[model samples]
Target: MAARRASHAGSWYSDEAKHLGKQLDNWLSAADLCHGPARAIIAPHAGYQYCGACSGFAYRQISPVVVRRVFILGPSHHVRLSGCALSTFTKYRTPLYDLRIDAQVYRELEATGHFEWMNMSVDEDEHSIEMHLPFIARVMENFKDSFTIVPVLVGSLTPDKEGLYGRIFSRYLADPQNLFIISSDFCHWGHRFRYTYYDRSWGEIYQSIRNLDKMGMDIIETLNPSGFTDYLKKYGNTICGRHPIGVLLQTVHSLQKSGNNGHKVSLKFLKYAQSSQCCSLSDSSVSYAAAALTFE
Candidate 1:
């Protein structure tokens, strides 16, 4: 079936099929691709060299011969999307392989009155979700049929709106067979990103930035919902996708409580490295992290 083509193939990742597949294999083999039965993954959306390893950890763990359907949620980076955007395409094209969207479930969620717009068109050029696909393809050979997706973009989600989208998404993916994913980069630091005050250069300043990100990390480590919001508002820590993370956590909490047995949510930090930490450029860079949270 003809569907959307790869938009970020050359820029964010490799455009060549062999290079893409080979690198995907190497990265997949390196991470915890076979970790315990998982329910959700929080992966980054930055460039391949920068954040690929971190993002690969979650996708590799969740995709290998298990699970069906992943509800990928990310914020609108290029354009501010209104409401949640569902994929109108039958299949999502990735450099590694194609993954289908669960049409039946998509239509079902569409009927729910909790959210508005249903801006399915926003998936076009939406690399937040697309970036995770190649990693998924590397793990699940029959990925197209093995797992489907309910791709949604979180753009302008107010508190009320996030709750609304959470409920609708909860209902749609409540089945025991599904997984959830929230695509996000933890914090953007440095003067270039404007997340930190020490602007000239963060060379070894990651120590200071680390202290700042600790505010966000504490919330993640302790699952402190309120403090997380407080820190985000106070520091203006351009996390870019806190809306999706909050809604996913909130939804998972509700779903487990209402289920026969509570769903388990555990977030593990796979890798945490800033561009400045790893590269010569320390003056202006973003903090990149890879983490996987399981919704049991």
Candidate 2:
């Protein structure tokens, strides 16, 4: 009966239920939903105040999916994980609701002996996966019943291991009842994040940084899985969730090869913004892009 409590609620987002509801409502209200039913989404996992509105662009696309479960794949910032870490907790607590863990799916995934199961407490310090819960809760709140979640903390993996994990997920993705939410921010620039290769004071240099983000986003929006990975390697994009997004791309590619009829997918770039654009701070900034992948 134990639950994984929200650790960043008050600071990262609103702690009070009503205030949190209003915050989410405002974001969703202003968001322009993309043209198709979202089978998957790529959203940023930074604090709600920092990237919440950007996240709404992706969430708005999947707002209409009548899903029973969501597979949240995010990078492990605090933990150096191998393969993927599945939470052992039974529920995930947020301001909106305590989401039930998809025990069956977790058990099934674990039974494959392909992934490691964490002691559940590991989630307490991991914000990448937890930060998306409230947005997901608010987006799916209108559904008849609460949906379950399978929180997967992705880590470093060898090519073979990555491909195997992708194959495992491809089957699940073939199902329409499930959704995948990839938590990631595009670029972390400035000396604060230790990625200071450019002088932000120079307008041209800053514009180039924005261009780099666009290049990455274009690769993702084109559904070129291999191209995305290659682009990251060529440019060393500091997208924190690259591994998670890599896995997602690998899984989708696997599904395509297997002739999964529903695997024909295309991504729509919904929005992009620099942290400086959203806040007063201009010295350092993290770029965020919201995109949705829809299946044919």
**CA-lDDT, candidates in order:** 0.69, 0.82
In angstroms, how far off is 213's CA in candidate 1? Answer: 2.3
Model 2 lDDT-worst window of ten: 275-284
Model 1, stretches more than 4 Å misplaced? 33-35, 114-122, 172-174, 198-204, 256-260, 278-282
Taking all chains together, each candidate's TM-score versus the true structure is 0.86, 0.93
**lDDT of candidate 2 over 142-197, digit per residue (tens):** 77276788899899765556678889999888887788999999888766776654
Off by over 4 Å in 2: 63-65, 144-146, 198-203, 277-282
Q: Global lDDT for candidate 2?
A: 0.82
The most accurate candidate by TM-score is 2
Clashing pairs in 2: none
Cα lDDT for residue 55, model 1?
Answer: 69
